[model samples]
Target: MAHAARGADAVENDAEGLRRRVAALLEAHWDEARGYSVPNPSIYPHLWLWDSCFHAIVWAALDDPRALRELEATLDGQLASGLVPHMRYGDAGPDTWLGPLERTSSLTQPPMYGHAARVLADRGSRPADELLTRAVRGLDWLWERRRTELGLVYVVHPWEAGNDHAPRWDDWGAPGRTRADYDRAARTAWNKARMHDVTFAADGSAEWSSSFVACPAGFNAYVAFNLAELAELLDDAVLAGRAAALAEAIDEHLWDEEEQLWADLAVVGGGASARSPTSEGVMPALVTTDRARALAALRQLDDPDRFGAPFGPANVTRTHPAYDPDMYWRGPAWPPLSYLFWVAFARLGLHDAAAGLRARTIRAAWRSGFAEYWNPEDGRGLGAVPQTWAGLVLAMGA
Candidate 1:
């Protein structure tokens, strides 16, 4: 009994230490001048869309005053057209292939700010009218300009998908147009091959010809999840109906029955689905009312042949030949993704699974010195170290 008690005490102490370190890391990344946390100092120094969303969520969870403040930064480049650029603040956020703009990226990322803002509201950090309005505008802009005829959201660029190097793009790859293009060279090629003619609409959303198009399970899932949350918070029935329609579309188009995984749909020449398992495929559970499908997708995480990993589910499943433990998106364990997945599982009533994922994610980030992403096979930090994404660990406690 005494030995067991000592072990438990040691575990508690370790958790407390991790919490302190994560807090300090988030503080260090905080840009008081900008009133938002920079994702990382070395590689990613500019403000980003989803990164800011996660930062705001972490701050809200800590009950810190910075929650709403950080969230405000997410709207830094909101145009009159209601589109918010994926990255802003400076040139570092812009890319050579696009966004010849002065300060913002030409594209948008997953509209995670909606979910972040709703989380803050629930925590009594409800944003003021301006914040809420911009949030709604951003969503409206995407719904109007970006939604496919199928009612599912489509990403014009692979980068917009936020899982840049994911194998879901392999079918439209540079070479085979269907090869396993892993390290992002194909994606870069696609970017460079663009017409280099980007025109901004009256609303300020960038418009380009011959763009890449795909409907990702994760991106659409987040759309549904965020829309559903915002509708409930604001008592908007139209948004609720839109959310339900989108969720139904995701179930109809993205779910792959044979594979028992949610596959990303590439919409370039036609509709092509990814065959390999990916962590993003499991995200629909957050809004999926199809219990049987949600449960099937959830089971993949427990299958060692697929997403199962020591840290969390691999970005790409372990069984795939493309799974590279140390690579960026191909197989690393990303903290922000872990948080999203944890919420999805919890929403699906898998409390124990969510708890395990939350604990593993916190420990993994702590052991990795708050990396941007890390090798899931080991606790080794990879990508940008001392990243604020690790700050998400505080949110797991919430």
Candidate 2:
């Protein structure tokens, strides 16, 4: 009994420490602009779309009112069409690379804003009506401008998918170049063309000649999840119907029965008809309604030669020829992705797996001081330190 009490006390102390760390990290990155939370203080000083979503989740978990402000700040950058840019630079800092004309990029990140806003409102950190209204407008914008006839929305740039350098984008010509060069060349060119069409054309017909457009399975899953959440909040049958239809479309088009996983499909030239199997592809299984299929897909997370690694799940299958534990998204285990996997596992009743992953993730972040990602093989922290989503470790306590 004494030993058990000591163990419980240790756990309590650890939780307290994590709470303090989350507060410090978030406050350190809080931009002067009301709710904007930078991913990192020194490295990423601008507000990012999905990063802010994760920040909101962390803040809401801590009962911080700043969570609502973070969501509102991101929405402030939303375009007239309701399309939110991937990142917004306020006042053009010294490190601003895109020049002084535009404060934000034309492209957007994964559709996690609605889901994040719902999370905050559910926690009583924000009003549901206000956030849901903003979410619906953003969803409408995406449906109008990005959704394909096939039902799944398409990403014109790999960065928009938030899995930059993933094996799925290998054929789209993303690897082997510095991230700076890749952004300046492929991303900049695509954004410029998109901006031109959206600015000059009345119908907003932006034709992407580049072969990088793709319907990523993970991205569509996020869209469907967000739409369903918004539909529930608004009690709108039409939005609910759209969400169901989109979910069905994803299962039909992206699911691979033979491989027992989901994969991306190219919507433009230059991309492979069949994307290489990666952890990002299997992420959609989290929202899958098919029990047997979801179970089968979850098995991939346990395969030693696939996502299963010594420390956590790798971003790409270990057996894949392109797997690189040291590379950014090719194989490194990211805290945000790991947190998503934990949520899915817990929802699927895989409590033991989820608990184990939560422990590993929290331990890794603690050891690395909130680095952007970690080596799945040795658990060595890499990339930006004090990353925004690294604070997701605190959510385990909630």
RMSD of each: 4.3, 5.0
Score every model by TM-score: 0.90, 0.87
**lDDT of all the models against the reference?**
0.77, 0.73
lDDT, candidate 2, 293-362, per-residue tens: 7777777777887788866788888987777787787788898788878877876898888888888777
lDDT tens string, model 1, 56-82? 998887778898998898986888788
Candidate 1 to truth, TM? 0.90
Best by TM-score: 1
- The worst-scoring run of ten residues by lDDT in candidate 1 lies at 1-10
